[model samples]
Target: MLSEQKCEACSIDAVALNKGERDTLLLELSDWHIIEREGIPQLEKVYKFKNYKQAWAFSNKVSELAEDEFHHPSILLEWGKVTVTWWSHSIKGLHKNDFICASSCDGFVENE
Candidate 1:
């Protein structure tokens, strides 16, 4: 889990990647969505499955990655969809962590 109070900035430049980048990333990922929320780069992904069991499994996978990165995102789990919002809680804004996690989430989608 990410420490919500720390405001450490990342060295990797953070920019709200455009559609081209998002599209390219999406080719290898299907469960994640790249979005710009409140003028910031955000990953608004919705993982769809037939039932809750699969959603829970994917949520766990995401949690594992979040724990490792120490940059946690907001997650919403439903019966068939899991929405993940990624941003740097530390910086209280966007950061490279968002992109890193977005990329990692993409890989997870591809692998699954």
Candidate 2:
């Protein structure tokens, strides 16, 4: 359902999701987890691949998707894995947009 949604422009005054909302939305994302970096909560997931080429390709796909959605994530491409962390930088916390993007990321692998 989240993958079916599109990200909206987040404003500086936009409120982040509360704990209950985070938990409920997280249920739709099985591989993603919430983590705190410098006290800011983020949704993170590491997708594994066979090699650097596969990982790089996957990261590029995610990048294009983020560009289209206008909601970017911090993506780390490694030898055989890519780590993606999504958070609302303006609000400095997790947002529904993060969950939507995370679900979209999963759809990439599923469709592969």
Candidate 3:
């Protein structure tokens, strides 16, 4: 179970893991559509938009957020959707940073 101190909400949980524990956490989060391909935990949520323009706009918004936070995710953009994944490379494992990014990502979706 995730520790309450690390929980960013019911949806985002912060994990302190070393290199060895990373794979395990990544695997676990992957079960929820998150993956550990970028040397960290990742998730690609398909955001639906009414048109290509809106999709691009949303992608840009996410880009701005990523830049401001100094934590970026691998983004996959399609006609009407954008997929964002979060991970940390320096620690070689999950960190509070990931949860912070997740919370920010969640806010984007929640507010939209």
Candidate 4:
């Protein structure tokens, strides 16, 4: 599945994946949604926690993961929910790395 894949260092010349490509990887992410924000395609998921502390902890874990992969996502940490939006900024669209990261986040929750 996509979770087993790793994020690659994307280049400015990297082209965004086509609809078929995005849909294929997106199938592995059960809770994630395809979105268009400011005309850029992205993958977003909301993770629910028991409390703020748990939510914050998850955010830290995601931060570490992002650092390790050298890819970052837009994260919104709330009282009991954390919204993570993933996209490839360098490519200005969706890339395999984004789905890889999103899958990794889902795997992180499974491990929790």
TM-scores, all candidates, are 0.65, 0.96, 0.62, 0.95
lDDT per residue, candidate 1, 55-104, as tens digits?
A: 88888888998887677888899998888898764444555456567666
- The lDDT leader among the candidates is 2
Runs of candidate 1 exceeding 4 Å displacement: 1-41
Lowest lDDT block of 10, candidate 3? 2-11
Error at 65, model 4, angstroms: 0.8
Of 1 and 4, the candidate ahead on TM-score is 4
Candidate 3 — which residues are off by over 4 angstroms?
1-32, 38-40
Worst 10 residues of 1 by lDDT: 1-10
Candidates' C-alpha lDDT = 0.66, 0.93, 0.59, 0.89
**Higher-scoring candidate on lDDT, 1 or 4:** 4
- Which one wins on TM-score? 2
Which residue pairs collide, candidate 4? Answer: none
Judging by lDDT, tell me the better candidate of 2 and 3.
2
Model 3: colliding residue pairs = none
Error of 3 at 30 (Å): 13
Ten residues in a row with the worst lDDT in model 2? 3-12
Task: Report the error of model 3 at residue 96, Å.
Answer: 2.1
Clashing pairs in 1: none
CA deviation > 4 Å runs, candidate 4 = none
lDDT of 1: 0.66
